[model samples]
Structures are given as C-alpha cells and as structure tokens.
Target: MRELFGEVIHTYTRAQALADGSLIDVTETAAEAGFRLPVAVTRTVWLRYCEWPEELGTGQSTEGRLWDVLWLAVWAARTAAEPSARITYTLGVVPVDDPEGDPVDVRLWAAITGEGAGGAPVVTIGAPEDW
Candidate 1:
C-alpha cells in the first residue's frame, strides 16, 4: 500500500494549504483539462476522513487528525450527449500545522464522484489493512 500511496503522502505534507475550491461552470473547459467531467453535476457532497494510530501509546485519534482541502476549481459539465452523464475528482489532501505545531499526517482522502447506483454519493475512508 505504501508503494502505491507513499509519494502522494510525502508530497501532501509539503503542499500549500488553504485553497479556494469554488464551483466552476466547466462545460467549455473539461476537454481542455483532460477532464471528462459531466456537463451538469446534480449534487455535491462534503466528507471528512480520520485515522488514529493504533500503537499502544498512540493517543488522540479524534484530536490528532490533521488535514487540508486543496484549491480545486472543479466542475462537471454534460458529456456532450448523455444526460445521465457524470464526473469525478481525485480531491487531494494537504497537511497543516495543527495546534500542537506538528505537521498533519494524512491517512486518507476526500473523494468525489457522481451519485452511486444507490442514488447517493459515497464518502469516508478506512486505511488499507496492508498499510
């Protein structure tokens, strides 16, 4: 798991925090960004993911979680033909200096995608067992 996500975690710690992620009407720009985002996003959802160290002496799983949302001007436009179309974003995470003056360790991410087959968006994450 670290082999797949190690670089992402490493770069996240150095990423700039506090970004503006307002919605953008991207019908005219999806193809340009190499983004096949949908023309119209039916809804947007907010999610928070947390991870706690399980070692014997680790503490504050609830309080130690540190994270930052990226500056994402993300928007989904129509598929140019299909109305049931959709979009997705790999919303990146960033570490911020917490009240303890420590750099946050990101164990998960905030993901984005069109509503699932269940008619609602999916949210939250759990660490991989192998990590």
Candidate 2:
C-alpha cells in the first residue's frame, strides 16, 4: 500500500514539473533526437523518443526518460491508441477546499489497464477544508 501511495505522489510531481518546464526538458531533448513535432501538452503532454543510427547515436535506445515516457502514455490515453494505450495522469477527486494552501486536489496518473486499475497523483494546491 505504501508503495502504491509513493507512486501516486511521483506522478503528481512529474505532471506539474512537465507542465511547468521545470522537469527534464522534453521539448529540447526530443528535438535533439530529431523529432519533428518535438514535445507538446494538450490537456496532457506528448513526446516520442528515438535513438537511431542517424540521431543521437547508433543502436542506442532512447528510452527510460521518465517525463518522456509519461508524455507518450498521456498521448496514448486515447481509445484508438489502446493497442499500446495507457493512463499516465488525471485530475482525481478535486475536493473543494477553501482555496487555501492545504486543500485536497487529487490528480491521478498511472498505466491503467481497466476500471479501478488506476493510480492517484493528488496535486493538492489549496487548504484542506473538508476536515
């Protein structure tokens, strides 16, 4: 249970980081790898990495970048991408707090396979009013 909770926190943190450009530079990184569109965020971030012979280096796997992978996952959230689809992040139970500094602002992010098979990345941005 604790492990799951920890993962949730990581998701929320990563999402905000990507959104704010404070995390790994997804745009520049992808561009350096020769991606035409590079990276973008439309309700969610989108990124695709490749380390082919012509780009980066030969036979190198452009993988393991956390934010990059998360962006791809979010892009794949569409039902059409189900062949390799996934749910990376989402706004969970946004409990209306008094707009303070400790409210419950839930944001879930995970590789959802089916119903109830999601992760919670709560991004609490206000006060906890629902005590």
Candidate 3:
C-alpha cells in the first residue's frame, strides 16, 4: 500500500504494457476459442508459439497456432480441480525452422490479473519465468 511504501515514484501499468507491445491482446481470438474473459500473451510466448514467419516455408498459420494455444489453455482451466488464479500447462510447438523435427514441449502459465481492462479480471498467458 502507499502507506507502507511511502509516496509512489513510478508505476508501469497493464495499459502501458499493451500499448508498448510488451503484451499482445488476443481477446478476440480467445473469445472465438471459447474464452469469456479478456486474454493476452507475453511477447515471448507469442514469438515462440504463435508467430509463423513466412521464410520458414512451413504450413503453420498464426491463427491456427494461436487457436491451439488458447484451446489448450481453456482445457487446462476447465479441468482444474480447484479454482485458482493461475494455471500452468505444457504445449508442444514445432520449431519454425525445423517443422519436421520433434515437437518441443513448452511450459506456459495463464494467470488472472486483479485489475485489467474496464477493471475486470483478464487472463495473461506467458512463460513460467515471465510470471
């Protein structure tokens, strides 16, 4: 609290992060994938799993990859025995450069933020370190 920390010097908010590209809004796509609340992903997660470079010459599409991530996240959230603000799950992503190679298992975490858009809770998917 401000009382404990004294006067606030600076603050970096979620809105700033979203505006600066640190967080990528995926609410629209997530809604299509069956999410009721807002959703976002860290830039690291987006680049690692969802961003499909055209130079890769692979059949992977960004839309499809994003859907896969959200779908898996939804399943993890729904199957959780206890209600929690955070959920961790693993998703296998084939490397863009090595599409034929074995899929790499990436651990991801989705957390509900206390204050998000319109002062509502929002889901943020990111690598464990990012949490």
TM-score each candidate: 0.21, 0.20, 0.92
Instruction: Write the residue-wise lDDT of candidate 2 on 68-102 in tens digits.
Output: 34443344344343443224333322122221233
**lDDT of every model, 2 decimals:** 0.28, 0.33, 0.88
For model 3 the local lDDT of residue 74 reads 95
Model 3 clash tally, residue pairs: 0
lDDT (tens digit, per residue) of candidate 3 on 1-131: 87899998998878998999989999999998888888999998898899987777567888888998999999999999998989999898987767778789989999988658577899899998786
**Which residue runs of candidate 3 sit more than 4 Å off their true CA positions?**
none
Candidate 2 least-lDDT 10 residues: 122-131
CA shift of 91, model 2, Å: 21
Error of 2 at 99 (Å): 48
User: For every candidate structure, what is the RMSD over all alpha carbons to the true structure, in angstroms?
Assistant: 16.9, 18.4, 1.4
Top lDDT hit: 3
